[model samples]
Target chain A: MPTTTRQWLLNGHPRGRGIEIDNDFRLVEAELPDPGQGEMLLKTHYLGFDPAQKGWMENIADYVAPMNIGDVMRGSGIAEVVASNGGRFAVGDMVFGTTGWTEYLVTDGKELTRVETELSPTAVLSVLGTTGLTAYCGLFKVGKPVAGDTVLVSGAAGATGSIVGQLAKIAGCRVVGIAGGKDKCDWLVREAGYDAAIDYKAGGVKEQIRELCPRGVDVIYDNVGGKILNDMLACIATGARVVICGGISRYETGSLPAGPENYFNLVFRRGTMAGFIVLDWASEFPGIRKRLEGFVKGGSLKYQEDIQHGFENAPQTLQRLFTGQNRGKQMLKL
Target chain B: MPTTTRQWLLNGHPRGRGIEIDNDFRLVEAELPDPGQGEMLLKTHYLGFDPAQKGWMENIADYVAPMNIGDVMRGSGIAEVVASNGGRFAVGDMVFGTTGWTEYLVTDGKELTRVETELSPTAVLSVLGTTGLTAYCGLFKVGKPVAGDTVLVSGAAGATGSIVGQLAKIAGCRVVGIAGGKDKCDWLVREAGYDAAIDYKAGGVKEQIRELCPRGVDVIYDNVGGKILNDMLACIATGARVVICGGISRYETGSLPAGPENYFNLVFRRGTMAGFIVLDWASEFPGIRKRLEGFVKGGSLKYQEDIQHGFENAPQTLQRLFTGQNRGKQMLKL
Candidate 1:
């Protein structure tokens, strides 16, 4: 029988902060797309929420283009193949890629990479997926942490940040985390194995980091950019390496926000700030994934996923991320 | 017989623009001290006036220390060894190092590097000394231009920029130059062999760059930093390398000014902005000098020196650089 698919389409641009973006998306019903030759029908299982999605909603020119009006809000998720006309995949096989915000999608299996892990699908897609790779390549390739180096990670309790802090620790460096609220701070220290945690909500983030890492930061993996980045730029040691992993703090803005005002600190300290995307190092993933998965299973590294159920609440669910309501990797179980 | 030496001493900090520094220096007479064991007395021949001298006068915490009040202002120039107790440097042999601004000075011969080249003194310091080393090592090590790549240099007709542009040409890359005046622009295109030259004084630097290098700038050797750097930041191609060789634009300001407002473009383009000091690569310099000298003698590369006779006019001489009165390498003959 032919089926009906429910999806959220971007109808308007976000205007205000927090849940303001809730009104930008509308839920609608569409007919299920059938698989043709060399194609497969994917049934959505889980949607991983990322700050980059906000960039797509704003229609701003950046690393990636903005999502146009009436388009299914772009997102990456884990899904099952319910029907297939493709030779590579059989029915009941699960694949991961940009499945969008929909219950069902028909693709030629062009972009999808088959999920081949025995662990829970959310665990693989959350930590072992793009989130893990982003932090892994960004820290190792760009930041280049050496033994006894002082590493700082902003948004340290979040999905990617949490993984980055642990990876830096495994490299035999002191890991300091900057996160908002007390719960996140506690988790970074108690669960994620950070050397120290700074509560930005309590203010004095710069002072705390200074007190903790008196020798000065050797590398920085910045997810949140703004005054926080400006303050940290001043405290780097000579020949420091700063990796621009993401700038979630300014993603909601209409125009690209001004860069950190104190970037000359790079000159003062003779440092290097390198911006990169994980896909640039995608070819080395098989080795990296095996390493990250070992850390996850060995209990040396810990990750958190904030999962919610129900596809109807997609808009408000995304709002949870911006409002600081999300505890970890924000995800929706459909 | 003991001789009296004339030198400029740092008397005050500069507070305003355009020769305000005239008051910052005071002419003083001091007895020429005799060289001790393993020491030599140097007779100053040419004092190289560079923008970094402004930083030395300000007494700020940077790569080098600030000149103290009533102390001989720190500078690097070419000098002839008049008397020597050290065997490494012989009497009448020319040497290069930080000889400061003086008619004659005595040194322990510790910092002086022997000048073995047969070229004229000003030519060696102008194109083959630290100025040339600053451009050569900076462009190759940090900027890392590849063949057929598009390279842009600011301060185009000036000492460092002229060498950098020609080096890019030698590397088989397309080179563009940005200079402040039409004459400088003509020299860059006609004399220095740049693919194109933009008169930044006429404005629209970003547009001109975009139009000339449709493929986008692969590497930028930036000598001036300010809005000019901000504009160039916007035109960099993906994975571009930006070498922060100098920031002459804001050197005279009282405070360290804001960084490029468009620096986030580094993240968008997945590029690198690296800061380096020429001394860091001093080991590779003997080889770099031979290569640069060959290009100069072969007629493929050219350099310019705006030489003013007299050490008494050193204060106003530096003003020529700030006010754009000097056409090329600003040099003061003792």
Candidate 2:
């Protein structure tokens, strides 16, 4: 008997408009093959959709290789190992790794990390996964927020920003968040314990930032780097730190964003601005994962999943991120 | 009889023109008064002529207060104590501080550091003073170069840049210097022990930087922050540090000098760009000064001073720095 599977592929490179979804992906049935030596055949349950995926689809070379034409879209997914070839794991084992967007996958058993079924499978792909890890590394390692420091997090309602704001609050730092809508802003302050939230869509961001952060921002966790980053530069305190994790605002433009106009303030205030990549701190992942796992289990750190049904909806879910339609962690249900 | 002493005062504020020597300052003989309680009379020996003094005379506020019209021009100077009332020092003690532009003056005992005459007297105002401390703090503390790292310094033959290049060499780094003239470039490579020197006066800075630092720049100590700082950004390796100690090029411009056209390089390379003020590191000075004094006494570090004659030439010597006429520290002999 043949098994049926559905998969998503990069149909075409996105220009200024957005990524295009087309006939590149196919739903087909194939004969189930026995596991080869050291290979595992897995069933996909949940797929992680992220803005970083859009960055990968653009074919621009960065820290990682871009998705090639007609290749299965690269993503993080939670899966069940239906069959195993060797002693690393037995049948019915759950795992996660850099798997493609598909209903089923065959891996060489190299990068697969076995997951404990007692833990929420979704949490492994969200808070206990790359999203939480990126937030941890950027905030603790790069941002280096001290107790009583004032932290400003841009993209505050998003997955990484939400986690960063909560982490800052736990560290006893006053946290201010910047998001797009009133609902998101409210959620940041009310649910995430952010001291305040600025709606970037409401206008007067620079002035509002100055007003909200009277002591001036000690740490700025930047994900959307354009006018927001430029304005934040003006409100930085002495010895402030600007952490660059992403530049989503200028990503589709396919060119470098305009440099911050008030960077000279760095000299006057004795401040620093640095960029970070989460993979660089992979050695410290176990520590972060343990802490984040505890928070998630204790309900101290909450994550919202904006899941789209069906693997076919992966492209549209990614569009929600750029369009600001998704509330939290945008994911695609397999 | 009252003693007559010559003093230079800020007569008028200069506009767009290079500080007009005639209209900007006026020399007059003033009656000397006895040192009051908690006050001391200082006989100025060498007045430090710095480019910052030009901005001080512009009628605009900077990091420090602007020079008031008719007030003595603000500066640091090596002085001999003629009389003392407070018990901090004796009559023959040598001191350095913001002693202003005058042959003799009375000041409160605050803001003065007694210089040990056993060490080189000129060094108390040059290498062991603000200029050398600025270089040391900006490089070792901010730039944070590691052994075998490739360090690039802009304004490489200036007082601070020259010392920074030598220090990077001492720390086991391959030092590349960027200066204006072939003579200055040769001095940087031969005398300062820089591994290579790029004459920024000649064209092709970007290309030359790429060729010289094929492995890419690990640290860039920037004093000149116009085109040279921009060029250094392209050649920076991953995790490089850029220290912004000063921006001499933008000091006198009517508008801000155009910032680096490629600052987005910071994001792609996962690097850091920071600016520092020397005063913030004031607490660390005692340790830095002790080590620097040993280097100077052992003849491992050499310093040069372009000592111009007469206090009347202070305004002109300040202008020479902008025109790149003086070789090292520009000072006026009282």
Highest lDDT among the candidates is held by which one? 1
TM-score of 1: 0.95
DockQ of 2: 0.49
Query: How many angstroms is residue A87 displaced in model 1 relative to the true structure, after the best TM-score fit?
Result: 5.2
Q: What does candidate 2's lDDT look like per residue over A1-334, in tens digits?
A: 1154566666666655455555433333444566678877888888887777776777774678867777777888888888778736678888887877878877676777888634567877778888899889999999999999999999999988999999998888999999998999889988988999999999999999999999889999998887888899889998999998887786657555566756767887788999877888888877789999888778778887888888767766667888888877878787
Q: How does residue B238 of candidate 1 score in lDDT?
A: 94
Per-residue lDDT of candidate 2, residues B137-179 (tens digit)? 9999999999999999998999999999888887889999999
lDDT of 2 at A312: 64
Please give, for residues B20-96, the per-residue lDDT of candidate 1 as tens digits: 65578889999987788887788899888887777677766477765688988777788988888764689988888
Clashing pairs in 1: none
DockQ of 1: 0.54
Per-residue accuracy of model 1 over A1-334 as CA lDDT, tens digit each: 3478898999886633433545688888998756778887888999988877776777654667667889998998888888888636788988888899999988887778788775677866677888898888999999999999999999898889999999999999999999998989998999999999999999988899889989889999888887788777878988999898777777555445556756666776788988886777878987888888888788777778899999987887888877778887899999
